[model samples]
Target: MNRQDDLVAEGEPEKEFNPGIAARLPRKTVAGGALIRDPAGRILFLEPTYKPTLDIPGGIAEYDESPYDACRREVQEEIGLDREIGALLVVDWVPVLGPWTDALAFIFDGGILDDDQLTLDPTEVRTAQFLTLTEATPRLRPSMTRRLALAQQALTTGHPSYADFGRDS
Candidate 1:
């Protein structure tokens, strides 16, 4: 098993993370998301088959896969597009659901590729689209909602604010 598959035991019972709570919950897993933008500055998002909420095109890092690699891979799988990842935008702790592990979230600014040539992976992606912040803000997942809020605030006001991605946080 690679680092992404490694579980860091929490000295407590596993908690269901559907409706996430961060009140002193132990963090668990490392995951990343691609903040992909089209030439017109539209962000690409997907509606997961398992959870039909709008979200960035990325997922957990794979064995021997760098966080950057994972980000790119997730986008390619979910959005059916190639990407160029930029600097790290955010790094926060994530709480694992039903197990012990830490999810370190790495957000990156990603550049997009030829839209006509993309091919989504059926096993991972359900549906995808490019949306402006005005459109995407209301459709994101709960965690992504928080992150988007923070990111928007930071962009508009230059305040240093961010959200924790873990189920615990």
Candidate 2:
């Protein structure tokens, strides 16, 4: 008897293909950033050489790293600021329809930094500046403005905030 005929005579049930595990969707990208403040009450903005937009002091989280840890690491790597990150401020869900999926961004509170403490990394950051909301308004993208607004609110209210790319109130 052939292999198929022998199996049928052995009284063993056929093994059905189960594709359950492979059907799961990929997880969204996770990134962490920091909203650092100065004694003048202005927010810190990093001038990234790679992008026109003024970014906060943070970057993407590595696998197995917590959001807070990623924030600290980014700050240290990008600006050489070795400091403790405060409570989480805002979590923004940003969507991209192309090659990448959506992103879950966490903006954490980086306590005030003095002028002398900053050590900028020339490769990632060109220069750093402190700007008020009004001054920063024109520089940031619409989504970034909304996220920053929510982050400032979280700081004032001592609570975390969320936003769905400025869609959800």
1-169 per-residue lDDT for model 1 (tens digits) = 6553454343455776754676667534566787666777677777777666777878888766778888888877776667677766666665655555756777776655445555777776677788886787667656666665554344445443445672223
TM-score of each: 0.64, 0.83
The number of the candidate with the highest lDDT is 2
Q: Best by TM-score, which number?
A: 2
| Predicted candidate 2 versus true structure: per-residue lDDT over 1-169, tens digit per residue | 8657976898965464775644475777888899999998799999899889898999888887778889999999988978899889898999895787899889999989876577898999999999997798888888889898899888899988889984435
Q: Report every candidate's CA lDDT.
A: 0.66, 0.86
Candidate 1: C-alpha lDDT: 0.66
Lowest-sum lDDT 10-residue window in model 1: 160-169
Instruction: Give candidate 1 misplaced runs (Cα > 4 Å).
Output: 1-27, 96-102, 112-116, 149-162, 165-169
